[model samples]
Structures are given as C-alpha cells and as structure tokens.
Target: MINKDSVESAYCFLHQKYRVYEFSNSETQRDDIEFAIASYVNDMNKELYAHLAKGRKEFLCNHTTFAADMQEAINELELRL
Candidate 1:
C-alpha cells in the first residue's frame, strides 16, 4: 500500500541527505548528481531485494515497482538540472 506521498517523502529525504542541490549549475555536476542518486538507489534495491528473497514478509510486495519509481524521479531531476 505504498503511496505517492510516501515515495515523494523518501525521495526528498534522500535528496537532502545527498546534498543534491550542490550539483545544480552545470552539465558535469548534473551528471554527477544523477550518478550519485543512481548508485544510492541501486544499493537500496539490492538490499531490499535480498531481504525479500530471504522471505522477509515485511518487505514491500511491489519493491521493484518502487525502485522504478525512484529511478524515474531521479531521471526527472536530472532532466530539470
């Protein structure tokens, strides 16, 4: 039952944690930001999938979709930058 609001909130939290605004002025900086966010999301997906595979019932049933949504957000941010 993960909602859009929750996804957005998580993205905002990660956005702040990663200091994404620091890379707002140039192509290179934007690329760096995109790479950083992608890497972070990749790590998160790995850990989440691992837990899901281990039969962790608490893991979201739609985690792959959640990861995709996060990735789409990152791509949109990169485009805006």
Candidate 2:
C-alpha cells in the first residue's frame, strides 16, 4: 500500500520540516524522528495485530516480515540518499 505517493508525501514532509543538517547534530531532533517512526510503526502493527486476532496467520506473518524488511531497506537507502 506504500505507493510512490505515500513515499513522496513522507519524504517531502520530512524534508520541509523535520530533516536534519548533515554536519551539525541535535539529539532532540533525532529522538523526535525516532519517536515519529516508532509511532507510525506501532499504528501499522496494530492493524497487523487485528488481522492476527481474526486468525489470518499467513497475512499477519507476511505483513510483519515484509514491513520489517522494507524498513531495513528504507533505512539503508536513506543513508545513501
């Protein structure tokens, strides 16, 4: 469901407001970004949890696994970008 539009929206939002400097550092900003991502992931996992409650084992597994993998890939790509 994370199509190009969603990615662009997230990237643009972060770029315009939350994106950090390359050399200068800020722990609070880092923490804020971490919190934001954690919150987003928590919300996503709640839907996965609901699916699990409904006995959709395959989808639950696939969704969780794919999400984790996608996050890792995105993290790597973010560094590269």
Candidate 3:
C-alpha cells in the first residue's frame, strides 16, 4: 500500500521538477521533464481511483483536494503552452 506520506513526497518532488523545467533552457531537459510529469500524473490518477474504488470519497494531497490538485497542475501546464 502506498502511504499518504509517500504520495505527498512524490507530489512535492514532481512540483519542484516542474518548476525547474518551466524555466529551463535546454530543449532536451524540457522534454525529459515533460515525460516525467506525465508519468507522475498517470500514477496519481491510479492512486486516486483506487481510493475511490474502496469508497473513500475524498483525497487530499499537497495541500489540496484531488480534483483541485489536478486542476492546479493542469492550469500550470496550460499556462506554459
């Protein structure tokens, strides 16, 4: 079972990786970070749905509800494009 602390730790790691990538100059670095970010989001979705399947209705990570967390991340990505 993935603990809440582990999930939160990953969230913070991805958050910092993204912030660095957002300002990075190398195209190759940006591409790598993009891939990493996509993978992290996919994993998060799996975790969220697993909780939902077990009848846990609400999930909080990185100081936000799951939906809010996703929205914030999506908004940040969109702003860059």
Cα lDDT tens digits, model 1, 1-81, are 434554454456555634543435666765555555545544454533343235543232233443344444545444433
Worst 10 residues of 1 by lDDT: 57-66
lDDT at 48 for candidate 3? 39
lDDT, candidate 2, 1-81, per-residue tens:
434444444445334333342222776765555555545444443433343235444321343353343344354335434
Clashes per model (N, Cα, C within 3 A): 0, 0, 0
Model 1 superposed RMSD (Cα): 10.5
Which candidate achieves the best TM-score against the true structure? 3
Candidate rank order under TM-score: 3, 1, 2
Model 3: colliding residue pairs: none
- The estimated TM-scores of all candidates read 0.34, 0.34, 0.46
Cα lDDT tens digits, model 3, 1-81, are 655664565556556875776578988886676666556645664653354334443322332343354445444434433
Candidate 1, overall lDDT?
0.46
- State the number of backbone clashes in model 2: 0
Sliding window of 10 residues with minimal summed lDDT for model 2: 15-24
